[model samples]
Target: MSGSGAIVLNETVHQPTRLRIMSMLVSVDTTDPLAYGFLQNHLELTPGNLTTHLRKLEDAQYVAITKEFHGVKPRTWVQATAAGRHAFAEYLTNLERVLGVRARP
Candidate 1:
């Protein structure tokens, strides 16, 4: 809650698909990024759809994306930035406050 007694939500992290994406990324080890294909399959998003959402997250500096080659195949990996992790935590806190639920330790 803010000083004005209004619940403010982060629009960037609040979007449904992006929120799910953040949740998955935040759960993984920092050193081990998720593969693009895995996120697409798990989230049931098409390639173009996933890429658009990823671009938005990347533009916000909330996620880092890396493209590389594994033999003759190209691979893309995604990881949440430190700032992103903090933002996601704050978002959850605000959401909990709005729902009158206590946050977990």
Candidate 2:
């Protein structure tokens, strides 16, 4: 939805960790792969916790995961889908408007 001067996101993406994950994905360019360990350390999540969250995101089609071997180790890389980016941007825009930082356009 359009707000003061930006778009807004629905309440569906309000969770802190999910938001952070989306934020981080938006910050990257190219297909720069990220390891599960990277997210684990960054998000301070246990393996199970991270997997559970990732599964939810994946089910929502907000993120994609690729499983492969990195040399001798299995690597899991995460990326946000186009839909995810749009939703996150909308959420931020709406949030900005709610915060009175933007005008509904």
Candidate 3:
């Protein structure tokens, strides 16, 4: 697909918040799941807004959400799945195609 210049967009990951979410996740290691609170704070999104967007990502199987108990407290962590990683990479390629920006090797 590289050099073919075909612009293929991943609609699931194309939403503004979703795109931002994938960008952040791609920057971190796969095993390093982010806390729910951290995402809400960093994205500046309300709890309801985050929840809705997360549900969409989860439904697409692009993100995996884990809920565990920290003693009496409930903790939720989110990470991108392999599928998400691939989708994000493809999204970047599409963005580059749209911008006519060639990626450096």
Candidate 1 residue runs with Cα over 4 Å from true position: 1-3
If ranked by lDDT, best first, what sequence of candidates would result?
1, 3, 2
Compute the lDDT of residue 19 as modeled in candidate 2: 82
User: In model 3, what are the clashing residue pairs, if there are any?
Assistant: none
Clashes of each: 0, 9, 0
Model 1 lDDT tens row, 1-105: 568899998999999999999999999987879999999999999999999999999999989999999999999999999988998999998899889998568
> Per-residue lDDT for 11-59 in model 2, tens only?
5567887887777877787367567788889989999988887887888
Best by TM-score: 1
lDDT winner: 1
Candidate 2 off by > 4 Å: 1-9, 103-105
Ten-residue segment with the worst summed lDDT in candidate 1? Answer: 96-105
Error of 1 at 90 (Å): 0.6
The 10-residue segment with the lowest total lDDT in model 2:
1-10
Model 2 clash tally, residue pairs: 9
Q: What clash count does candidate 1 reach?
A: 0
Better of 1 and 2 by lDDT: 1
